[model samples]
Target: MKRLCTLVAAVLVSTSLTLRAQAEETINYITAGGIYLENIQKAYLDPVGKQLGIKWSVETNDVDTPVRVQVQSGAVTTDLVEFGASTCALGGAEGLYEKLDYSVIDNSELAPGTFSDYYVGSTIYSMVIAWNPKKVPNPPQNWADFWNVEKFPGTRSLYRNAFYVLEAALLADGVPKDKLYPLDLDRAFASLAKIKPHIKAWWASGAESQQLVREGGIDMIGMFNARAQSVISDGGSLAYTFNEGLIDFGCWSIVKGTPKKDLVMKVLAEFVKKEHQADMTLLSNYGAANTKIEETGKIPADLAPLLPTSAENYPKQIVTSAEWWAKHGAEAKERFDQFLAE
Candidate 1:
């Protein structure tokens, strides 16, 4: 009887192991549409998956509709997500993101408070003014200067996105930087109206903005600093100013109903480590969310001007008001669409 019982226990243990393996067939990670995915796959997914023994698959999209639909439909396909400031707020407001229990994760190595109850910032990026130095030897220095198209004549490419561009327009029209939130809609639209035809195209994504300047197709642009950094690194004749740049960050969140929430939080904590964050920044040309990442003191001097975290640049920039923007985003988008239609 003892031998028979031992044989049955062994069979049960094998069956349990098989079931667990089958349950965690893969970890689904969703990311924003950008070149940053190249760095994320290299710096985080490949090595981290090898360490954790989980299969990793990354999917990318431009907006949050898929995530929203999945959550509302009670069919959560994405286990982990990395998204921008606006999307993070949208998820939080819509109750689509998981309430992270950080007890299983180690965030001691990250900057203080980088981890939130529902989300963790993964990287820092900024929407800043960029110019082709060759084309405009005396480039604009501030939001006021960028609006002076008659003095600095050339085709400009502005951000097509509603939030950043609206805030920027308000600033250009004399809305104090600190008072930009709860925007002045009429003046903002008027400011954009004044510059509409001067804009050759409104860039819809990072790649589009980067290509605009890299190919010397446009003279001035409001572009993400990370994309501009790549251009400068490649010896492309482009430069950017941190002044009046709208500071924004990307965050990682777990889907509210994912079975792999624990594993997703593990990846989030590991990715925020100073060393990992630094390597990711190096690869993607985007700033690490970890404030503790030590600069290796090897940043390119020309590109330094575009980096928001650089000491000289950080002081002059402004952090975007995520809450206010999120609250007003839908209405602002409608207004912008109407303005563009005119």
Candidate 2:
């Protein structure tokens, strides 16, 4: 009888694992549209679907509003939804997100707190001058070109942050890439003044930037490279150049109370593989969350040049200096505020 019971227990565990894979064969996911959705389809959804013998339903939007609304309705249509960290925390606090099972999703290689009980960050991105080549057939190649509105006529947008804005202005005024560490506040502001009237919006968030591009709100805008590519892939009239792009990171998360948690969690687990993360970089220029990606040589030699952290792209772009900003950020921000008011 003891031997019979042990055999039964083993059978049950095996059955449970099978159920997780087979239960809810179609997992619904929602995220920002464009190349992001396309890449996920190639790197995660399509491949994982094949492996698990399942299908996926994906929805796209510019923000988390639909995901939030769906969860609030207590009948989440989406099994997995992605967001930046702060909004993910909000969803968790409001009970819209549940504590993720670390046992199911590997967190070993991930940055600490990359995923809390609610969210996970899987990629790094860069800010770039995204423009519609059709609108301005010959768009800006560098910051100086961007400021030459007469030469490349177009409505423009920029980030609300003084960091990128200041650096760009100094560059527009002919400051060398290496010499941009201690930003020239006086010269930077003056450069901005020349283009201030043509500035259609000072986008405050990633979502707003997407909205601008998706809706054709500007002829050219400073935006995330991934998002610009995403919208362009989704049929928005935009393309990006790397001249002085800013680099940063963001997070992703799952919705709470989705009935198919087991299957969705499995999908999340598949995303943890360094190989899959590397595949994501190949699909989108956004850098991978996997630290092992570089060491593993997952990104190809030719492809590496196109990515943000690559040897070729790094020298030409602008990365914010934390040490420089730590001291001068306050005064710079104050001046930017005053300039905006003026």
Candidate 3:
């Protein structure tokens, strides 16, 4: 009876080993919803997985709601997630994300201005002045200039998102970059109200804003540069100005309570390597989060100007405060909705 029991225990242990090996064969990553993940998977995840002796399977979806459900129910499918800064903040507050292992990941490899402990910003994107050059001979260069419809004179569109428009309003009201935080809510709202009558449409999506400018629904817009670049590249008569833009961040994080925690950390450590980071940035047309890529002559000139790494432009930009936004996002949204309704 003892001999028979020992043999059965050995078989059970062998079976467990086989299952563990199978599970480690592939790592899963969750990405932001869109074609963006295809490039990220091909450029970053797949190759890194191979280097780390794992296969990668990535899915794209909006963060927060799906992630919240998964964690609360003890059904965490996502191993890694790429989401907006605001989403990362919200997820952290809910205790849904794992604090990253900075020792293995090496924060020094990332571009100087983009690193953090809980999450690493994946890209720097901005809301800028997009104009149809043919329609307007002189494009707006600064906020004061942009707000001068009497001179630039045309129908304009801006983001429907509260965070962006509020910053733009402050800029238009001559608030310097250094003093933007602790934003004068009452004054900012009032400033936005002044431009309310001039807005042709408040764009609600990247696609919507792109189409709005391309189709001439509005001659000028406070636009997300990535979509604007897409429209312009596709032969649309649109051009963008980066001056006084609202620079925002998107980040990647590991979800807490995942069964595949070790695998996820390995994948992240590989994901931020210089070569993979450069490849992802080139395909995405966003700033590569890696500093070494910028230093080693890897970045292309045409792409360089658009990226946040170039020496000239990096200093001009303002880093959005994710922690502050995360804390106040719901309250800001509530107040913003009320302001819009009125």
For every model shown, what is its TM-score relative to the native structure? 0.88, 0.60, 0.89
> Which regions of candidate 2 fall more than 4 Å away from where they truly are?
1-24, 111-113, 129-155, 159-195, 200-221, 226-244, 295-297, 310-342
lDDT of 1 by residue, 212-255 (tens): 88774899999888888788888998888888888888888888
Clashing pairs in 3: none
The backbone clash count of each candidate, in order, is 0, 2, 0
Single out the weakest 10-residue window by summed lDDT for candidate 1: 296-305
Which candidate would rank higher by TM-score, 1 or 2? 1
- List of clashing residue pairs for candidate 2: 35-230, 120-252
lDDT tens readout by residue for model 3, 1-342: 999999999999999999988865765667765657767777876687667778767676754677788889989877778888877877877688998888778777775546565677676687778888888888888777778879888889888877778878888888899898877778888888888888888888777888788775688888877778778778888888677767777788888888777777777777777877778777777766776775556677778777654566667666666666787777777888897788
Cα-based lDDT for every prediction: 0.79, 0.76, 0.77
Q: Which stretches of candidate 1 lie over 4 Å from their true place?
A: 1-25, 106-115, 295-306
Cα lDDT tens digits, model 2, 1-342, are: 999999999999999999986764877777767657778788877788888777878787545778778877876777787754445665666677767888998888875545677776667677788887778799898888889999989889998878678888888899988898778889999999998999988998677898987774688888888777668668877888887886545556677778778777777888877887888888786876666676667677876755776667756676655445546766888999999999
Better of 2 and 3 by TM-score: 3
Deviating ranges (above 4 Å) for candidate 3? 1-24
